[model samples]
Structures are given as C-alpha cells and as structure tokens.
Target chain A: MTTFQPLDIVRTSATVTTAPPAGRDVEVAKLIDVSKCIGCKACQSACLEWNDLREPVGTNLGVYDNPHDLTPNTWTLMRFTEWENPQSGNLEWLIRKDGCMHCEDPGCLKACPAPGAIVQYANCIVDFQHDACIGCGYCEKGCPFNIPRVSRIDNKAYKCSLCSDRLAIGQQPACAKACPTHAIMFGTKTEMLAQAEKNIGVLKTRGYSKAGLYNPPGVSGTHVMYVLHHADQPQLYAGLADNPSISPLVEAWKGIGKYAGMAVIGATALIGAFHYLVRGPNKVSAHDEDEAKRLAEAPK
Target chain B: MNDKAPSGAPVRVPRYSGSARINHWIMAIAFVILLLSGLSLFHPALFFLSGIFGGGAMVRWLHPWAGVVFALGFLMLFIRFLPANLPELTDFKWLAKIRYVVSGRDEFLPEVGKYNAGQKLVFWSQAALVPIMVVSGFALWTPGLDFLQSTFGIKATMDHRRLAAVVHAAAAVTTIVIWIVHVYAAIWVRGTLSAMIRGSVTGGWGWRHHRRWLKREVADGHVKSG
Candidate 1:
C-alpha cells in the first residue's frame, strides 16, 4: 500500500516566488501514463481541497463522477473512455485527467475579455481569479479540449488552472501527488516529454502497437500530456474538438463590439439631448404649450 | 379617424392594467440583470463583469436564479397578455405598411385597432419567447433529463446556458428596440404615457393614435368621457 503524503499533515506555508522577471522563461509541465492509471479519483478530490474549490456533492453520472462535469466550482475532472481493441480482441477502459491543458497558445487566454482571468503562471499552469472572469463562451468556443465550462449561477467561464498555487509554492500539483500509481506525474515539459517517449518505447516492446502520445499539433501543445492505448485516434476522448482553430471573427469583434455599442447609444443620446436643449422652446408647438397650461391649471 | 369629440360625449378606454404594468417592469429589470451577468461570464476575458454579482462565485451561484426569476416574471406577463397577442386576420392588414407610422405619415398607417402592426409584432414575438425559454431553461437546469446531462453533468453547461441565453437575449434585444420605437411613437402622436401612467389620455391622444379602436370603444359604450 502506498502512503498519501497528505500535504496538510506536515502543513507549512507555501514558499513561493512573488514574481518572475520578463525575460525569465516559463517552465512547462507534463503528467500522464496510459497503462498505469486505475481511474481512482483521488486526484480530483485533492485538487478541490488544495485550491479551496467547493466539494462536489451530487448524483453520479455513469461512473463515480459526481457533480457530473466541470463547473464554476469544479475545475479538474477525469474523463473515462472505453474502446474495443482491434488487435487484442478485448475491451479496455482509458482514463485521462480532463482539465485545462495549459496549451502553449492558450485559447481561454486568447478569448478572455478580462485582462487577467485566465492567465499563465510560473509552471505554465493556467490560473483563474473569480473576480476577473466573465463567463463568456468565447474560451469555450476557442478551446480544443472544450475545457472552459460555464457556471450556471452567473454564467461565468471556469476551467482547470493546473493547480497554479501549488506550483507557486514549490510543490507538485495535488492531482499528481495524490495519484497512487504515479499515473499522473509533474515535471519540466522537456523531462516529461523524454519520459513519455521512453514509456511509449517500453509499451512497444511489450507489443502495444497502437500506443502513442497525444497533444494536438494545432493546440500549441497542451502542458498536460497524455499517453493512450487505442484502437482509434485521440479524438475518441470526451470533449475533444473535431477541428480546433482560433476564431478570427471573435478576435476582430470581441473588444470592438462593446465600445461600438456604447458609442452608438451615447452618440444617439447626446444628439437627442442636444436637440432638446438647443431647440427646446422652438420644438414645443404653440398649440401643445397652450393645451398643457390649460390642463395643468384646470386639473385638481 | 376624426380628431373631433364623439357626438354624444367623450372617450376613455383603459390600455394596460396595473397587473400588466407590474409584470412588464419586473420582466424588464430581471432581463437586464441576466444579460449583464451573462455577458460578463461569456469569455474568460469578459470575466471582469463578475463584480456585478460581487464576484465570480456569486455570479456562478446567482445566474440561474436570475434566469428563473426573469422567466417567472415573463410568465405573469404571458398569462395576462396572450389573449390580446393572438394573430387576428385584421392584424396582417396593417403589417405591410407599418413604416408609415415611423415616417410621420399619419394617413398612411392602417386602421389599427388597440395595437398597430408594429405593437402587435412586439407583443406576439415577446410572448412566444417566454414559453420557449421556460421549457428550455427547465431542461437545462434539471441534470438527469438528458443522457448527455447524465454523462457529463452538462445540465448546467454553457451549451445549455447559451441556448436559453440566445433566446433570452434575443427577446430582450427585440423588446428594447420595440420600446424605443414605442416611446418615439408616443411622443410623436402625444399623450401615450399619460394613458398608461394616469390611466387616461387627452381626447386628442386616443383619437389620433388609435383612431379605429377609439371609435369602436365609443360605439361599444366602453368609453364615455375622459
């Protein structure tokens, strides 16, 4: 039996660096192994606890998945996929942690209307602050993983931040640390890539032909990497996009629309006010003023 | 269509009841709140508006309830207004030439009864969206009704929220635009707000703005004096 390091048992304050200089490069992360995960959901719970995210309590959807999917409250999730293997004549269950991949060209970052709602941290973890986020679906539309889920209460956008606070404090993410089998690991992107390649080679020797790493090329490479056992492609995962690309239309109109709408209404109002002020007495017809005075004096 | 007082006495017809006004304003306020909150949450970048509900979590918690409140308010209006909003054969007669009302050409507008073609369009379209949003909103809120909801907890998803959102927002946009037109018409012809606010308009307002309706009300004995 493996021990849960349980960060709280020997609790200490996070010794985090306040800031990284402009020229300092972001250290990216990678964590996953297809064969080892038993789909145990300790990672999900730990993530919620570490981040001060609310505990999810609700009816389960097919698996032990509760609260069903990611929401404003729950940012990280484990996706379960089942497939029939062509080579092995047996079925297999594939589990991948479904959260913000913290892509190099982050879609949520691109689509955010606020300046700092979804942001990159030292570990290339995507972070969110409730105060900054608008629940616009532009991030939902732009993401290849379809990671940004809108909260029902205020319609604000929400998704994984890769447990940014942990990285800041010089600690492994709650998800990776709680993962019993080391199925989820965290490290520099380069080291993680090296380990992923080696793991695939070992699986190849073990005669798993379809085994491969997955990080869609067009997504600017997700910080969270995956190794999969497949009878098919990576798109088999839940929430995977058919085609992923940034919407030029959104890019063009996003900021411009708000200002444009304000300007139109403001200009119209100003002109109307101008007309009223400049042409007030003239605009009021002689018949109208006489009738108004008569009604005012005649009325009780 | 004459602006002259009726031969017998005068004209006084109630336009909107107190219940109708109450329902209308409630729906309007709720719709505006929902729209602002929804816009703030639509994109991570737009997250700045979360402050409207105090912050992000508050927005997340309150958005659904706001939707529920807005829908219920609209339901009250629908229950009260549906009968009047029905498409009468005569309604279509006025539809083709509604532009005349806006063009300052009083003579060209059709012999509109209580509501002109423009008003009729706003009323019916707004009424239609209430039920659509209520049904869609429920399906969206209750998690287990659809299998996708069962699998992904997508019940409260942006997909669901946005569907109702589009309808909710579209209805609001149409309503507000119509409101602008309505205000312009009232001022253009005179005394429109007086009837709604004070429950009476000058004889000139009723005759010039709703001539056909005024004539019928007087003939049917629904009006006597203002």
Candidate 2:
C-alpha cells in the first residue's frame, strides 16, 4: 500500500558551480588594556632598539606626545589622547601604542606599484623590504590609517616592519619585552586572541562596562589586535572608522586589460608607419599642416 | 619610407624635430634615473640602488629635479601634440570602446584620427599631473612659502603645506600606476618599442592594424625625414 503524503516534493538536481573559497585560519595579534597602560614609553624604546631605528629626527610641536606620532624613522609610537567630558565631569588621558597591525589585508600591500615592496608574512605581519620599495607612494594611498610614512630622503616608503628580524629568531617582539607593565602583549595569534578575550571579560566584570575588544575582521584581519578601554560604548567607539578593507586582486586582474589596450594602440601606431613605408616620405603628421607648409616655404 | 626613392633622392620630413627629440630623451633619461633611485629609496633593501643617481642622498636631491624634468617633457609634448590631442567629437566614440580596445579582440574598436582613446587618456593625465606636481612640490619643499607676519613677528596662519603634500603624494601615486600600464602595454604589444624608436613599421602590420591611419598616410603623402 502506498502511503499518502499531504505534500509531495518534486525531484530536483543540484547546481555545482566553481568559485574561489574563503581563506583558512591564520594567526593575528591582540593588544593592551588602555587603562592598564601607564603612559610608559617602554614599548616605544623596545621597538626602536629592536629595529635599530634612529633617534627622533624632529621634536614635537606642542602635543604632550613627544617625538609626535610615528614617522619613517620612528616605527612604534605611544599616542596620547586626552578627553574631557562635560557631562561625566571626568578628565581622562589615554596612551595607545600604535604601529603596523601587520594586517591580513594590508592597504600598503594593495597600493604598492612595485611588487614585493610591502608584503604579508606568515602571521599576517605587514612586512617591508627596503631594496624592493620603489617609493612611488602608492602604499600611502592604500592605507586607511595612513601609517607608512615616506621619507623625503629616498622617496622609499617606511613603516613598522613588525620586527620581522626578531620574529625570525622566535623571540618576543621588542616592545613587549620592554613593557614594564606587560601592557603590550605579543604571542602567537591564537594565544594572544584568547588572552585578549579573557582580559576584556575581566574588565567588564570589574565595573568597567565599556571595556571591549577592537579586532574588526575586514582589514585582512590584523596581526595586532586591541582590547580597547571603551570598545563597548558607541560614544567612545564611534570615532573608529568602519569597514577597513583592501582590494584583493588589483593589477592581478588587470593583466587582461593591459594586453587588450596594447593590441589596439600598437596596431594604430604601426598602421601610421606602414602608410609612410608604401607611399614614400614627406607625409604631414596627423596634425600640423601649417608647420609643414612653413617649412616648405622657408629658404633652405 | 622616403619621398626621393627610385627616380628621386630620399626626402626627409621632420616627424620629431631635434629639439623635440632632445627634450624627450632628456625626460626619458631623467625618469629612468629617478625611477631607479626612487625605487631603491622606497625600501631599505634596495637602498643600495642609490647608485642610479649616486646614493641615498643623491636620490633624495635628484627625485624632485627629475620630477621637474618629467614635467618639462610634457611641456614639449604639449607644444607638439596639443593640436592633434585636442578633444574632438570623435574622441567620445573612441573612448566608448575603451573596454574593447583593452580586450584585444575588437578589431573594429574605434577609428581615431591621431591619438586614440588609451593614448589620449595617458597623455591627458600626464598633462594635468605635470602642473599639479610642480605646484604641490613647491608647497612641500621646506621654506616653501613666506609666512605673513603679524605685528610682533607672529606668523599668521601658515598655508596648507600638508594639503599640498597630500596632493603631491596623490599625483605621484597616480603617475606610478599609469607608468606601470604604459610600460606593460609597450612590452605586451609586439614591435611597439621599435616603431617609436626607429620611426618605422611593416606594411601589412599597418593595414590590418591601423587601417584608417595607414590609408591616410599612403594615399595622402610620403614619409620623409626632416
């Protein structure tokens, strides 16, 4: 006996289409508790010595953040931001150590005209090669934060190399080593991310409701993550720009376009030349007949 | 490709005059030098390339000057091709096939007079960018502008040098991207470099390629050296 069904579904076929799949898991970094940071310049000093960057070339203008923000010479910086809220009746000063996040999708890498000038390493650290940098300043356009500073000297791009040399030796980054308060934590991407989550949990438990993490996934995901003091509150987190992203395949896809333009342009130029070959010399240019006339009229 | 062949001597008609060629070569040399040096300086690894000009210091000093020379080359190109490159009603038609022109398949891409869409775009970009770099460049140079001092030697609002710097950077970036496409296109198409340098091309290569242009040249007059 056939069982009677209330509804019968029609037999269907599956559509199989080929497309690029999303990437697999890759490591990234986590950052400091702004409240825990005591305005110490430990990380800054460590980064400088580790990278062997020269001393500050120029002094600050007026801001308390000495040596000002990061430069071509100074890779890591402790940015001092002061906020005075009228309603809260509070004056807060925060120091954020800013440098190359070594983003999974680094803007510099996208904007670079010269291949291999700026690259991404295993852990997503934004890496730079001095020899390869053409200093065309394309990376400058690519960066959302405008991090990589171009030195006037060589026109080469400059930014934090993420202590690529140190990472190769399997040592903690210099800034982390130098931090007296353990404010700047450095470790494997997974471990650091786990640590960041725990720290944020604790901050929230301790009557600090605004404490949250700042690891927006879009910018190729960052090797450097953050546990921002006010990540939760819209008033505080609102300043952060949303959707930090980069083009995946820029010139890579343009290879086809380049060839197409060449074929047409080349054909045109050669046609002009061939015409001259068959007809004999003394052709007027595409324009400038008056000049040709002037030349003919002039005495030799 | 001479007017004075067979029964007559090969006649010379000026295509690129001596002054024009000299300007072009200088610009090209300057660009190469600056490009190599600039690349070296962009990253530390290539810093050794400082030798193209001299060294890092030399690259630094020469970069702006090279930019100035590159701009000057445009001045000459403007002097030469301004008339041919002027925007025309046909330009829009040529521009419409930009995608087809780049695709390499559309044999009937668009009939253009002298400079086609792609070449025109490149030329026009160069024209606009040259002056921009010059103006923004001066703003970037230290002591770029004199400050208007108030009563007690207090300099008033300083001009937006940073803005100029940003503009300069934007122009530089745009130029580099264009240069990449320019060079890539030059190499990608066969025998292009030969035509520009030697000033000649094959016959059939002309007809199937630039039928209109070739037809004009052959039917109207002869190719001659100045």
DockQ each: 0.12, 0.07
Docking quality of model 1: it rates as incorrect
> For residues A1-300, what per-residue lDDT tens digits would candidate 1 score against the true structure?
002112211111111122333442456676688677887888888888877788546876667556577777777777787767666777878676777777766756655555445555544555555565545454674565667777767656777666655665677888899999988888888888888888888888888887777765676677888876542366666545534555444333343544454455446556545644543421223333333323333423
User: What is the TM-score (0 to 1) of candidate 2?
Assistant: 0.57
Q: Cα lDDT for residue A257, model 2?
A: 27
Per-residue lDDT of model 2, residues A1-300, tens digit only: 011111211110010122222433245464766667887788877777776778645766877565776688778777777777554778877667777766766666655545445555445566666676655554655565557777767667788766656765676678777888877888777888788888888888976677777676777467777787677542342234455554332222122322344444456557545644544432223222333333333443
Q: Could you list the CA RMSD of all candidates, in the order they appear?
A: 8.5, 13.7
Model 1 stretches with alpha carbons more than 4 Å out: A1-24, A36-84, A90-95, A105-115, A131-160, A174-183, A235-300, B1-13, B31-70, B82-93, B135-172
> Residue A103: error of model 2 in Å?
0.5
Best by lDDT: 1
Tens-place lDDT digits, model 2, residues B1-226: 3332322222222234456667767877877776676555343345567765655545656777787787778787788878867777767886776665554433555555545667677888988887887777655443222221222343322124434544555565566666666665555544345455655543333433344554455445644323
For candidate 1, the per-residue lDDT at B182 reads 50
Model 2, residue A111: C-alpha shift (Å): 2.2
